[model samples]
Target: MTGPGQNPNGPGAGLPPVPSIPLTDETARDVAGEQSVGGLVKDVMTQVSTLLRAEIELAKIEVGAEVKKALRGSVFFILALTIVCFSLFFLFFAIAELLADLGLYRSASFGIVWVAMLVTAGLFGFLGYRKVRRLRAPERTIETIKDTAAALRHPGEHS
Candidate 1:
């Protein structure tokens, strides 16, 4: 659901921001002993793990919300489309009658109208099929997740 120019990993993408869990500064100069450093590393690791889990949860929640909205919208869209299709019968009937009034055989006029409607439906269905075929995975979101993973792996390196 990232908008135009909005970073996939930005605040908007993960509305519920990560909790304020303080992570240890691994670069801190004050290191009393190796034991303390190990404890520090452990603490940092735990914090990072928690942060990663939280970020994942945020992603799941956001995606779920967007999916629910799409599902609901599609349901309404289908309902509207169904109604429109049914309503089109009257309009096409009027067109057929008009054709018949123009000196064409009544059966011929109705046949032509039916054929035209079928061709139009086929054209639209083909276009919809093409659109569906062109659907792709969310590359930006995948890239953002990769970047986050890289950042987490190399905490000392700044990108």
Candidate 2:
């Protein structure tokens, strides 16, 4: 008869006593090697694997946060750009009409207005490119990766 958690044929079963002996030198050496180097190596590998998994999870979270921030910023920038573009269009049309009324259409006034519009478009494009570069700079991502790798490499160094 055995208890619920006890296996009838296992060591927990009521059985005859067994003899014990002192460990021999070769047996002791084998056991020591398994407990020391082998066990240590297994533990280190497990820790590193866990650390890498945690870092990957953190990277996913950080990337998602960064992407959300970028998207929100882009939305606001697009809205502002739309308003500015419409305002510029209206202002340019008004100026062109004024030049026409002033008897400048047959002269270089129309060409100058077109050239100015082209320059304005190019300037806005350049500004947008600069803004995107600033927003998506790799510095933050690189820093995060470096910090995470360092933490994983020396987890015990923190505290």
Candidate 3:
């Protein structure tokens, strides 16, 4: 006979009673190794391994939190980008319409708008290219490498 979902003749019913053992630090130390110099070394190694595992777990948790923050910030950046793109599209249309109302044909007005955009793009591109070209080598790193090469070449010259 069983009560509710319980089975009287279940898999665990006929199992032998398991003995409980008291676990303590001394027991753990004794089970790991005998009291000797080798045992001391083994204990130290085990403690170091435990410490490294805890440090690695802490690093993983910190990195996970940083990734979550970056992802949250990215959502807001994406929303701002979408809104800005739509606003630019409407502004372009409005500029073209204004030009057409000033007596130009609609097609010509749109073409003028496109040409103006291309000129602006070209100006920005040229400025960006100049800035990139101006980026120089790391002076301190180059100097350090040069010093190292000189030292290697003339090792006996140093006092």
Candidate 4:
């Protein structure tokens, strides 16, 4: 069903059609409400609550879809990491063999492998630290929230 201001012939046209109920005397009376301040406030609160619930449900659905996508992506990364681990194991062994063939002792060749692994680990650690340092709060969302608060505090003032 199309929402307020939405085009009826747009994408939402494919959705289930809203039921057509004839406005009989009984139905009209049921639809009408007491014309009082308290009634108006209660009606507004009910609408707001319903809108909030719909928004929360939409968020949950969107988040679930995103999490599913992330899980699928993680599977591919895990497979890649597994293959790379095995490839690195063989690569280090091959390098050690090459060093030994070049007249270095087997122990010395393996010692070089240990040093190389340590250096690689240190480089990764440093990169991770730098990435962590670059992390910051959501600046735009914070700014928008501040603006909303200001507008609410002074309804007549435009910020």
lDDT of 4: 0.55
Tens-digit per-residue lDDT, 1-159, candidate 4: 567877888843534433322344646666685458888788756755654454445445445555655565555445544554654675577665664655666655665666565565555555545544544444433454466457658869964
Give the TM-score of each candidate.
0.48, 0.41, 0.42, 0.43
Encode model 3's per-residue lDDT on 1-159: one tens digit a residue: 444665568842533323222345667766676778887789766755654454445445445555655565555445545554554664577665764655666655665666665555555555545544544444433454466467658867863
Q: Whose lDDT is higher: candidate 2's or candidate 4's?
A: 2
**Clashes by residue pair, model 1:** none
Which one wins by lDDT: 2 or 3?
Answer: 2
lDDT (0 to 1) per candidate? 0.62, 0.58, 0.54, 0.55
Q: On residues 27-141, what C-alpha lDDT tens digit does candidate 2 reach at each position?
A: 7777666767787789777766665665455555556656766675565456556655655665666565664545555235644655566566556656555555555434444
The Cα error of candidate 2 at residue 79, in Å, is 1.4
Candidates in descending TM-score order: 1, 4, 3, 2
Model 1 score (lDDT): 0.62
Candidate 4 regions with alpha-carbon error over 4 angstroms: 1-33, 99-159
Count of backbone collisions within predicted model 3: 0
Between candidates 2 and 3, which one is better according to TM-score?
3
